[model samples]
Every structure is written in C-alpha cells, then in structure tokens.
Target: MKILIAIGSKDFSKPTLKLGMKVAQAFNAKTTIIDVGEKISEFSSQLVELAQDQLESWDFDAPGVDVLEWAFNYLSQNKLIDTKQTETGFPKNRLIDDGEGRKMVYLSGTACEDVNLILRNGDIIAELREEVQFGEYDVTILGKSRKRNMSHDLLQYINSSLLIVNDYEDQKFDKILLPLDYKDGMLKVAKYAIRVALALNVGIDIFTVFDKDKSQKKGSNYFSKIIKFIRRSGVQYSHEEKQGEIVEQIIKKADKNKIIVMKASDMSPIKRFLKGSIPLSVMNECDVPILIVK
Candidate 1:
C-alpha cells in the first residue's frame, strides 16, 4: 500500500513523524512525506505569514530559518533524509523518490500563490492534492485538526482509505471495530480489516446496526462470506448486531483505544456532502481514529 503523509505547517513535529513512520512500517508500505511551503512576500520581507494556514505565530525569516529549511534540517538531524539531499540548497519545488526505496519519500511544493493567482498559478493545497492523486496513494495520514477549507476539500477528495492519526500514543490498539452494513464489496473491507487486525494482534468485532423487525436470516446470510473469510484468516473476532443510528451506534460501542474501520461511500462529492452518509457522519462525530476503506 502506498501511503501519503502531510506534515503540519511544513514542519516535522517529532511526534507526528514518529507516528507516521510507525504506521508505514506496520503496513510495510511506501510513504510520501509532503510539505506545502508558504512564500515570502515583499511586504513581509522580514518574515512570511501565511493566512492560508493561519500561521501567524511562525516567523518565516529568510537565510536558513524557515519551515522548509527546518524540515530539511529535521530530516537530516533524524537521519530521515540524507546529508546529500540537504547540501547546497533544497529546491523549493522538489519531488524526490529518495532512490533508497526506503519507507519514506521526500516531497515539497511552493504554497506561495494566493487565491487570486490560484487559477493561473496553482496554490499549495491544489499542488498537494495533485501530488497525492498522481502517486495514487492508497491511504493518507494527517493531523486530527485541519484549519483551512481548502485543506478539508483536499481531505474529502482524497478520502480513499484515510487514517487520521489522532493523538496516537502508540501503534497499539485494543480492538478494531468493523461496521458492516452488508453492502457490496464488504468482503474486501472485511478482509482489509482482518489484515489490520492480524497485524495489530487485536480481535475484530464485525458489527451491524439494524432494526429488530429485520430478519436475522438476512444479516446472517449477508455476513456469512465475510465471517468465513475472517475465520480462515484465523483472526480472533466477535460478531454483534445492534439497533440504532449507524454513526451513534459505532461511536458509543467503539472504545477510546479501539480503531474503527468502515467502508466509505464513493458518491459524488456534492451528493455525499448533501446526504451526510453514515461514514461521513462517523468521521465528524467520532473522536476515535477512523480507517475508511473505499
């Protein structure tokens, strides 16, 4: 699986980097680390203040002390990026494969353009989104909080199998909650969840929410394949049926230590927003990190 990781404000918070690295190693996946650089304007020559990221507190002074410079230094300090990559000067717009075929890729794009110039000169958000799409990343890891509307749009667009790394103390998770509604392609979701569950060495709870009036036979028939798949994988799991709003049910049942894995709807963006589908609802309402498989 190819994974994309976004650094907050183009800076490497050690915790964030460690968390992303752990996740990449867990999946044994190739990872792309991206940072959007805010440009230095003539008016703000002393420092660059990006209103886009609401980074007023940060002083982006020139000559070795900006976030971009900071990123390279951090990588070098942590031995994430080679000293060669840091020599001379780091490029403003760079796409490096790193050649090592290691777990992480180093990427940075200019986030200097304003909204008025976005059409002619693409902005940072657009550039970041484009890179992720170009890489066809299977999963993207980002901070729990995203400030800008454009950042949110990027998230929604690239919502395919997202793992929002919220307060990740460790890679450890108590259990994984798989919310199955018996939809098509659910077996794939189940298998994916099972793989993760196996990796985490945690039991999987294959659950569904439905009214009592509905026939148990239908739920049993629908989940039979998925159950068989999980059983074959030898993943310890329990199946449960609850009755309530899907989002509410999952949130209440999912403990703080549990990671929730659910299948996301691939409906059109506008349509999905209007509908506020169960997955979206869970994403907004639940405090737990969600692994949405599309």
Candidate 2:
C-alpha cells in the first residue's frame, strides 16, 4: 500500500509526519513526503532563521550536507525515499493529481485554513474523490485534538469519506463494534463495516441498543429486526441487544483496542449536542478508532 503525507508549512506538519512515519514503518507501506510550498508566518520564519543562525555558528562543518544526508537516510531506512517538492504554482491541485493512486491523504485543517481555498489540499482531494471515480484510496486519516472530541460535522464528513484515525495508535483493534438500527443508512454502514472487518481479517461484534424506557414488545421487535439484518448479510458475525443509554453501554464494552462502527443520521446536530454521536464519543473517550458508516 502507498501512503502520502501532504506536508505544508503549519504546526501540524512535523507531528503528522512523525505519525505517518510510524504507521508506514509498521505496514511496510511506501510513503511519499511532499512539501507543498506555502508561505510561513513571520514568527515561524524568525524561528527558522534563528535555527539557521545557530547551525552556522556551530563548529560542525558541512551542516547543509549533514541535514540532507539525515533526511535521505531517514527516508531510505523506512523505504519512504520518494520525495516530491511541489512548486507548480498550484500546490493543492498538484497534490490532488499526485494522490491519484495513494492509499490515504493525511490532512490537517479544513478549507478555512487555506488562503486561495482552491489550494486547500484537504478539500480539493475530497472534491477530486467526488468527481473522479477512481477508488485509489481506502481512507483519509485526519488528526483530531486530544483535548476534546472532534466536531460533529467533521466526524460526519469523515464517516462518509474514508476511515478517520484519531488517537487510536496505542490501541490496535482486536474486535470491531458494529451498532445498527436496521434502517437503510444503518444497513449501508453495516455493509461497509463488514468490508472493513474482512479487509482487516478481524471479527465483528454487532450490537444494537434501544431506549431503556421503551416497552418490552418494542425492544423485542427492534432485536428481531437487527438479527434479521445480520443474518441477511450472510457474513460471519455475532450480535447482541442490550437495554441502556446508547452511548454509555457502547463505551462500557469498548476496550482500548476495540473499534465501534455506528450509523448517525444527523452528524451536524450530533456534533453540537454530542448526542447520537457514538463515534465521536468513542474517538474521544476510548483510545480506539471509530469507523462511522453513512
């Protein structure tokens, strides 16, 4: 598999690059480190100058050659030596074109972060995926703040586009959580989850929850519908129906490594209320990745 880490001048560049390096090393995936020429702020520029000054003042000889050799060695050691410096006067457009066969594009900020808006690699890549029907990438990994849960709109967009990786590196998924309501949207998500599990060769623990105060008859009907959906898929899976708060029960069973795949009808409103935001909450509370299906 090939992974492309879209690098630009931002606070997120280094950390995102580090994370990408770790994953690429683990998966033996080919990586391309492309630096999209974007302007840097005055403060950052000053910092760069100060660092350069210190380097010049040092007793070390051939500092420039050392730096280049270090970067080359790092990339070579990890089999990620493919480096492309974009100076096409259109970074984002060129990035989308370069991402033709990439497995994923690790993005930072949204459209507001870009000046031209057209050069926003994240949005442009998304537009490319929508317009061009080349299923080159399976997921676009976006880093979320460890401080709080990500916004609902972000989560929703993430769910539909590709697999979103937050802070789940510490927890590798052993089992997957597929929560369904048996609606068409939920069924679609269920199918997506099945494909992911198959790709990862992992077992899925499918489950559903209903209002705790609902009548037993209604609960039974919901359970029957859920079971019917799973059986209809003919995919190897196990399921359970429990009565409790939707998010609470879902979290209770989740370990550090187990992923929860749930369907949300309204990703925007859920982002605000943090209700019906099972995936977001899971990404926040658990150190596991939440795969949201549309």
Each model's lDDT comes to 0.60, 0.48
Residue pairs with backbone overlap in model 2: 152-271
Misplaced by over 4 Å in model 2 are 1-139, 156-159, 166-171, 216-235, 267-276
Q: Which tens-of-lDDT digit does each residue in 1-294 have in candidate 2? A: 434333443444444444445544433444444332334466686686577458656743212223223333444444443323212221222223244322222222221111111122224334333322332433333444444633444554332333445444423666778876544446566666665555455678887776588743333465466557666755567877788786777877766666677765554654446454566665566555565544
TM-score of 2: 0.52
What's model 2's lDDT at 274?
47
Cα lDDT, model 1, residue 133: 69
Superposition error at 252 for model 2 (Å): 1.4
Clashes of each: 0, 1
Q: Report the lDDT of model 1 for residue 164.
A: 63
Lowest lDDT sum, 10 consecutive residues, model 2, at 109-118
